[model samples]
Target: MKHIKRFIALFFIAAVLSGCKEDMVTVSYPEYTKAFRNPMKGFREYFGPGEDKIRAEYPYPYGSMTKEYMQWNMIEDDSSDGIDKIIAYSNHRWKGVEDINMKVILRVLLVWVEPWHGGKAKDPNNPDDLNGWHWPKGISPQVSPYKQIPGSVGAYVDPKDKTTPIIGGYFDPAFPERVAKLVEKIGQAWDNDPRVAYVEMGIIGEWGEHHDPDLSTYWPPHDEPEHVANRTWVPGMEKVLGDAFTKAFKNKKVMVRYAYEFKDYEFGIYWDSWSQPQEQVRGYEEMKKLGDRWKTQPIGGEITWNWGDLAKFKSFEQVVADKHTREYTIEQIRNLHCNHLGGITWANFNDPEFRKNAEILQKAMGYRFILSDFTYPSEIKNEKPLNISFKVVNTGSSPFYYNWPVEVSLLDAKTHQKVWSKTLDNVNISDWMPGDDWTIEKEAYQKPAPINEIKSSISIDKSLPDGEYIIALSVLDPAGMLPSLRFANENYFEGGYHPMGYIGVNKKPGKAMIDKSLFYDIQSDKTLRYNLNNN
Candidate 1:
């Protein structure tokens, strides 16, 4: 009996040892995490380094010149109190708009509503130099203005303007109404009354500078604390102005500017008054309400705030932290959840340093803003010997330098086949100054067998079989010769759109044909010469 018991105990011990060994045994598992990668990091890896690096195929003259329009620059000087400077600037901007296939623009500085002397174009109704009435002014010398409201002509107005020169506020009563009148007069001057791209006021001025400190001052019978507690402007300012402007322009999208910039992968936010985040929220809320009515928009600007400027700070750590604070402030503003969130404007165009910051920030932020007109050419046509000419304009506030490669293709109208192909390389365009116009001219094949080069008018070759043909053009921005991502984006500016032009043919020709002249009369009409025999 004792031996049997001992045997059972031995068997139990062996089973326990086997179980421990099994628990300690190593097991094999896949090494990969199998998680998704970040999209931004992926984009960076794919594109390599720097901004505005896009690969595009540039086609030539046979393709239409997509960006064949022109531009004019007009600067407003603060020193000149007389309207002469303003008038001259306006005329210079519109110098050839009426005679060209382009749009007219008048750029000006947004300052306070102050008195000014009138020039030759005086108001016939108010003969007492009514144009000199005190106008709305912008706070802070830092805000950079780019957009305009339809009613104010091309000028941006501040909601806070007064008759006196106070530190932070405007002195004008009914400031909103005054701005509306300004917009109306300006629009009438351009024959487009009350311009629609209405006033984009910058939110950087010190709180309670232009008007009273309490919300009750602007909004009569101010009773609601909900509207008063953290309001930027008085309770009713935006409501009244937004309503009036919307009624007149019939368009929503009121412009509200914010200081926005990106540094070291983070966004920086600053207002005219860094002390009043609550007031800033009030202003943002007003604009948000307006945007809710139709489509609200937030126009972000890259105001000048350099960490290098803050070198006096105790340590580089503090300076970097401050810079980071600015970026975080903007992120907080975006979190406010307003509609029509407009893109950022990288302030002064002439500064190269500003461009560098804009480039990186635009990529990191995933936001977009317009750079006016930046498209390549679209269509090109020829008779026998052909010459093509077009213009490119830098509508943004900076210069654009890039090599344009042009390709010319002749298509068969009947069979839809390519008969001739030629690519022009290393076409260098000198500095395209902001708001300045530049032209491009090229001459291609000159064989005029089917038509006479002189007697026949300029027309596309129609001598291939009975089929439709088109000439196309594209551009490759390998060197990143354009502006930052904001200006170079395909969605924001036409500057990056490839394959902009095309030409078509119908049948074989038997007569002399003339080339299309690039000349335009004062009325802005095209002069075309063609041969009936080719058709």
Candidate 2:
């Protein structure tokens, strides 16, 4: 009997040790495959007026653009309209933008210069040339009492008769006040609009570029001495527009043409001559001096190949095609931390080589969120908190400017359809930032990208049936509450969501048998209004 008691004691001790060993064993989480490019950050395609004709032609993701000529006259032609016209116009222009999962960068312009070459007849009534004088009726150019330069000719020559001189409307004393009032009206119309991504402070200069012959430092004074006084910025004009935009746009980010122009305000830059070698002094260097400003504000622009040293490239394609030029262009993009660029709107994306190189440039521009790791319990109890943790690394140059919501969902195990979803309110996705201080020599950021570990305790619905479910995650665009920003992960479903692993309610999950064939393509899924394809 005593021998039997000794054996029982030994067996009990062994059983206790086995139980502790099982409890202490670490739970293994599945590794997520990293993806390259995602949405809402790279390559803003140029969009113009026209509803049915305009389509997102690119494949990568986001379709966005800086739209010129939210012209003063087009929005509110008369003061008597009391901003009603602008509100109606904006509402019409952005009618289906959000539903299509697109964003527009807008600028209210006062002047647009028609593309002119010597000896070409200019038409003042050309609707296509939304250029020329855009100021509303009753407002006229205020001529200076004294000649700006003793015998100098005024800023502009009549388009029809080149010999006739005309003063630029920027000289009008009432222009600033009118612009301020107009800007306020624009804010009333667009500040809260979800379709609008950014507002460029573009009331001044031509094409809203903030550089007219009268206001540009880069453009040389006219060869004739008479045009010298015309090549200068309006005095105190910066403060007037700067203060107006600062006060008007509390929600939307505002971008200026130059970083130096709006020094006092925390405005972003829309450098028109981005990556042009000749613009190193006025453009590249000036923006580089801002240091980490790109973290908070966007740095975006177009790469124009028609002017200055850019002419050496001959064309946009040649610039991206040449190995040397392409590398330099990407270096500049990384150095300045650019978010989006224009000028590629016309590029032949069908060409394999051009598309390949373009993708490289696109990947380098904006936030590229990579899901490195994801963890959740193998079995989740009903009416209990399902704890989940994940790590994201932004491998790209810039941060996502907006704070969109992150969602955790459970997919039907057999069908792979989303069964339940909950937006994680605690996650501030915008804070998941990329590395900084890019080094051209190594072709890497000086600082290594930091990992963002997000932890969330989601409540499993008590009424949910006890069965296995595939767990997934997705970032919502907020405009449509649809999964818009895709994770750079190989585990992505055809829809925007990323499938992580499997979980069970009230039971251990069976082996995950993922059927890629069962997944529905986001493009064909009419139920989902957000179309992934350009069409």
Candidate 3:
């Protein structure tokens, strides 16, 4: 009986010892944790970076651009997770948009509401007079007298008085010449800037609204003959301003407030009649005729009133008079096919409930990319080309307009230093727009039918020492030459780059190739006591 009991205990011990596990990474359980991609899109905040856009604190308020507020270094950010983008009024020049690496919507304010001072034939200013505005660098001391709203144009009663230095009206005969000259200057400054996302040909009405504010709409209402005539659109006024902006911003997306007004030019639409019947003022029917225009250019603007009260303001006049406003719902946002929503209160939207609402809109805005899947080898031979097959689907309403540079990098496993980097030249991300259309009954939208498959490859240089290295991916700006964009994945690196996965360098990473003489050379460095001291 004693011998049988001992045999049972020995058998149990052997069974337990045989069940030990090893820490090796298997194909099913890869070393890297699978992180799901977040489908958050960015909101174009004019005041500052809003809470919904960056997933954090909203930035302090900043006002729109004026002639006086043309260029300056950015106010040092007091908070973490800095600003992303700004919708700016151009003073015929680009500010420090690139310095902060912020994307910009450039609105060329050719005629502010006052009265036109000159026309298209106006010559460019003298070189000495071009001081780039009130730069603290001590340029010319000419200060702009342009004022803020309420009195932006109403304050100017006389049409002939140019001595006081007022703004411009659309019907001013020389207005086209003046705007054309300003457009030329604008092209010289910011047309090709990668930071400039869209340039609104906002050279017509009050604040470049592209509308002739007659007595019915102009605030502090005026029907004076001079004011009426000054606000009227002449035969080619629209053509002049539209054509000028189109030519000026040759490399950027140019937009017009009213779709039909600038019918002569090829440009996008920045609809201000948000939440209202798009056709109430203009832009709906004509823009609708532009089927799939969103694929190439952007369609965006600020909502007129509270999104909840979509019927409150069907016209520009009502939007200006409404005492209150609210945010738009995902359905309302999708209805207009808007790429970005503006003029909404950013600070008030931080509440958990409101944030949840904003999250829905954020996903609906701009381009929300998702890395559906990627296929690459875990093991790659040195000096051989590495091919990474991946797919990206833009789950947003609009496409990413820029053809940014897509690059692949091999990094040192431990240090994460760059070993070899190469760009994927043929990948056209602009063509990857997965249109988001809502199925209201289902409470979810159907994403674009197609997933863009990119089978991009890069050759590893033979000079790079083989060892275990990590592979990464990034889209860089050619100007700043830095990672200018973030991928949709959860694995974001420090400078907006994303980690695709790991790659094994020469068979045995750090142990691969080293001359014995190099090891001995390190020993002599220890004889440095005198030099190590306070020399």
Against the true structure, what is each candidate's TM-score? 0.32, 0.82, 0.64
**Model 1, TM vs. native:** 0.32
Candidate number with greatest TM-score: 2
Candidate 2 Cα misplacement greater than 4 A, ranges: 1-38, 47-63, 66-68, 91-95, 114-129, 141-168, 213-231, 512-535
Q: Sort every candidate by lDDT, greatest first.
A: 2, 3, 1
For residues 108-140, could you state the per-residue lDDT of candidate 3 as single tens digits? 332223332211221234311211221121112
Q: Candidate 3: list runs displaced more than 4 Å.
A: 1-41, 47-100, 110-169, 213-230, 277-286, 306-329, 344-346, 443-447, 508-535
Better of 1 and 2 by TM-score: 2
| Candidates, ranked, TM-score | 2, 3, 1
Higher-TM-score candidate among 1 and 3? 3
lDDT (Cα, 0-100) at 82 in candidate 1? 40
| Poorest lDDT segment (10 consecutive residues) of candidate 2 | 22-31
Worst 10 residues of 1 by lDDT: 36-45
Give one digit per residue, the lDDT tens place, for model 2 in 413-468.
87677888999979987788888888888989899889999888888664679888
lDDT per residue (tens digit) for residues 1-535 in model 1: 9999999999999989875431111111111111111101100111111222323321110111111101111122232224344445445433432221122212122322222111123245532222221223442222221124444423232434221122222223444454455434333333331111123322112211122223233332122222222232344443443344344432322233332211111111112222124444544444333322211232322222332233344432232235454354334333332111111221232355543433333322222112222122122224443333323332222222222334434544333345664444433422332221112121111221121011112344444444334332223222222111112212211222211123433332332111213111211112111121222
